[model samples]
Target: MPVLVNSHPSPPLHIDMTPPKPIIAVVTGTGAQGRAVSRAFHDTGKWHVRVLTRNPAGKVAQAFQKEGMEIVKANFEDKASLVKAFEGAYAVYSNTVPPWHQSYTNKLGEYEQGVLQADAAKQCNVQLILFGTLPYVGPEFMGLGGVELYDAKARTNDYITSLGLPAVYISMPAFIDNVHSWPLVKAIDGGAKLEFVGYVVKPDKPMVFLWVERDLGPSVLAIAESFRTFGRPLAEHPLNHNVLPVGSWRGTWGQVSDEIEKQTGIPTIHNVLPSVDQRWHRELTKVFHYQNTHGLFPTDNFPTKVFSSLGVQYGTVEEFVRTKIAPMFRKS
Candidate 1:
């Protein structure tokens, strides 16, 4: 016996060698989609959540900070600032609003900021990069007039892919809240009845709808979990991590109305408008027609397997309208 160790080798020193959790920095993580993404990652308790915003002093930022997130002040136009914010982060989740949405910039600035963000992430050596993008409807020949919103993001997507960076492109759909934002509610019979209009010209056209605030978190969380399980975290270019579209319900607009009535027992009619009467009708009309033909995703979109295990509240159009929409109107 070569001096057999006594007393169980000093009890292994009883040290706390547990490693720190990975960090996830969310860029533009304040709006509907970003807010949901930030909260989803933060709630896991496995991730150190950090959010980047130009205004860290805003009410939304304050609210997010109160919810236990690290808020970093960063501007989309400043690549250096973004890199600083993204430093030490393992993953970056980013979404950019249409510059026109808030009347913030004269020229379409999505492409510019998109490039800056991508460059920053690339420079920072982030392991996973997720961007919110929309697909374009064409082969550069259809000449869709109101497609600038989609086109700007499409350009960004191309740039990111060309960089061969590990990225996830989140293709989002029309928000269920659009009816409220665009306001298609017309008081029928001078308040005797209320009609909520849908964007489809035909009753059978399939449209994809998602209440982003509720569903995006689970959608992104699904991807994050997948990355942890089987995704290529070490590989240089994880091309397999490509476009992931998220939607809650895809059906006729009539189905949406029926669900509202069925769940809330509210009397209402599903009004299908021939054409949208909003200021940007030309583009909106084209968008409707694009869906009428190509559909949002050609081959059976949004597989349920991705998010089935999140164990969170899943929202559907019917439930959304019943709970959120029905309250907007009083008894007829």
Candidate 2:
């Protein structure tokens, strides 16, 4: 009974107050990759997402803003804007669109943007950086050339490592989402009977494919969280400077087409390309040849364990076609 007199329970101590979530700066946040990353982290309710985009007034930016994300205006070519956007960001996801598609720039421009983003991240003292990149499948591999896209990104990867910044290289594979863009899908949409186009590679040759919005975003979110939780102090983390080859499923193109037919209930036929003379066709042929000769990953490793630890389960190719691809035909 010594001090048993009413002490108001210490005012119920506010020790349970939630800590503020880390702020992650997503470069090109309105794009496919950036949007996926932002949505994944935002869904977790454990991160404050700040997206960097040149067009904050665009539809995608407005949509994101309505979802409670912070959008900042920045351009890849403008290092100062990037620095300002990156200021106080706990981490950054860096990506550059292949300039070949942008109509004004070339591969060199893409590489420059990557370097500028890395430099800006460095200046802003971002704790971690994840690069969306591909393997440097160049002539050095087997006298196979024409893959300037991959080579430019590989050079950027090298530059990022040279900066001595904490980084993770996430090598994205061919996207399953591209199936919609393929002539096969267009033919189906136009009421033509389905016909599968086979490439120069063998039917049994394995290809890696990812459902970008489904697989990529979650994988990136896991990597970012893992770096924060386990990758601090650099040397203690296994992922530091690690190259993670990511994809949803690995299958021969034939197998993928078969799955598509099965899921879509469309009869299909497979035929090799009539010609490979066009620059685009020639470049793609080189890619298929390289993949057939060498493998997509550096080692046979697939990072399954890492993805598992992060609780990410990739959807099967059939599942993707059923849920994502088949619907397009119905819409048309």
- The C-alpha lDDT values of all candidates are 0.71, 0.77
The total of clashing pairs for model 2 equals: 0
Name the runs in model 1 displaced over 4 angstroms.
Answer: 1-16, 103-108, 139-142, 180-191, 199-201, 229-233, 236-239, 264-266, 269-285, 301-313, 330-332
User: Against the correct fold, how does model 1 do in TM-score?
Assistant: 0.81
Please give the lDDT score at residue 99 for candidate 1: 58
On residues 18-121, what C-alpha lDDT tens digit does candidate 1 reach at each position? 87777888877786777888888888888888888878998989998998889999877777888899898878887666654542342437778788888888
Residue-wise lDDT of candidate 2 within 179-234, one digit each (tens)?
A: 66544454444565576666566667777777887888899988888878873585
Best-matching candidate per TM-score? 2
State each candidate's clash count.
0, 0
Q: TM-scores, in order shown? A: 0.81, 0.84
**Lowest lDDT 10-residue stretch of candidate 2:** 99-108
Question: What TM value does model 2 have?
Answer: 0.84
lDDT of 2: 0.77
Q: Quote the lDDT for 218 in model 1.
A: 73
